[model samples]
Target: MEGTSFLKEPVGGKSVVGKIVDNITNAIINGELKPGDKIPTEGELSEAMGVGRNSVREAIKILEAYGVVHIKRAEGTFVSQEYDSKMLYPILYGIILQKDSTNQIVDLRKVIDVGILHLAVAKLAAQEMPAHRLSRIEEALERLKVEILSPEPQVKNVHDADVAFHMAIVDLTGNTMLQGICNYVDKITRRSRMMAMDQIISEGAVEKFLEMHQKLADLLKTCDSSQISQIVEEHYQYWANVKE
Candidate 1:
């Protein structure tokens, strides 16, 4: 209301709180509001948008809960300045609630993973990966290999190892936003991923499963992204099959 006019009157058809959330979100996205910028106080927003202070309060609470904004006791509410993994919870839970989201989750994971790999490759080209970092990834991979190849593997152990192995690769990329996205997508697809790994081992395809993990590890070492698509696709085959 003072100088920033992005907060306008809420239109009809949606809940007042929802519209307020939308207006504020759009403002942040369009650069009318920026990170660390304090949004208008509740009284100002209420007066400017012709909405009740209660509605503005509710909307701000929701946004804060989602990590879209942070409130300081005396300072006022400001756009979050850094990546918050909580921002992804809505998407994660939305996918979880969908009737048939396994395919979508699998595809999402593949795309994120492939992108992460490419980022890792580019990082590798620019600077030598720390020996300790590569060792940690290989350690996770080794754990997966051992768990999957055991005479009688525990599903939980294998699943945890599988997740750790891939997450290690994601962490290697050193991008917080990608890490947050990958972490949530992993959560959304957890059940299906575990089931897929279980079936792969049961069907004597453990070798292929292990090989895919090996190839993923090798890709970081080679700094080659040409085959990333194929490798990631193959990595998700079991999960895709289970979802089908």
Candidate 2:
């Protein structure tokens, strides 16, 4: 565990893995290593951080589990920007072990969602959805259907599709800043939802959420702002029930 600390100042008996995880997480969050950027190699990281290669490897393993970085054989490791939102495995476990609840994340989502919903509805276009954009929604909806129908749904993938569905909605606005903000929230919200729903929530919970996302996608395709508002209102009622 030599030099395994965040600052390499020789910390206490806490898990070296945890410290390394924090350091790498901070790097990504602070934009020191932006998405699509390549991170230093395992050997380089070990030397730079003054930690053992094993310790650096273990840290990267934790990050890899969170979808924070992608490892390529013979190529190298690259930062994954679309992580957790794209996949939630070890992250789901880590959050759950902390005794956090999905409802809490849902609450946060409610705040961000309300604003996004309003903007999306107001920006709907009758025929302006580019093929690529429409394709995103369609794929997301298709994935949603599969999740809802499958008894043992792949919740993470379904959730990914859910984000994709909403991303298409925000993309409709053609606002780069708005889209980026929406994506940031999506990443943040996902960590919580996967922890709560995928790990600690009900068995068929994903199916229900998949159903909700499907309905939203269907409404989005209609390209009607008024309908979007109505659809979201009805959809939110389910969220209310979920709490009780």
State candidate 1's TM-score.
Answer: 0.93
Q: Using Cα atoms with residue i matched to residue i, what is each candidate's TM-score against the true structure?
A: 0.93, 0.48
Which stretch of 10 consecutive residues in model 2 shows the poorest summed lDDT? Answer: 2-11
Candidate 2 colliding pairs, count:
0
* lDDT of the structure predicted as candidate 1: 0.86
What does candidate 2's lDDT look like per residue over 138-190, in tens digits? 77677667754566666586567667767876776676656655676566556
Over 4 Å off, model 1: none
lDDT of 1 at 3: 56
Q: Write the per-residue lDDT of candidate 1 for residues 1-244, one digit (tens) a residue.
A: 5557676645457988999998998899989899999999999998888889999999999999999999999999999998899998887888777877888778778888888899888877788556468888889988988898899998889998988988899888888888888877877677887888779878999888888889999988888899999999988888898954
Instruction: Write out the backbone clash pairs for model 2.
Output: none
Tell me, what's the RMSD of every candidate?
1.7, 8.9
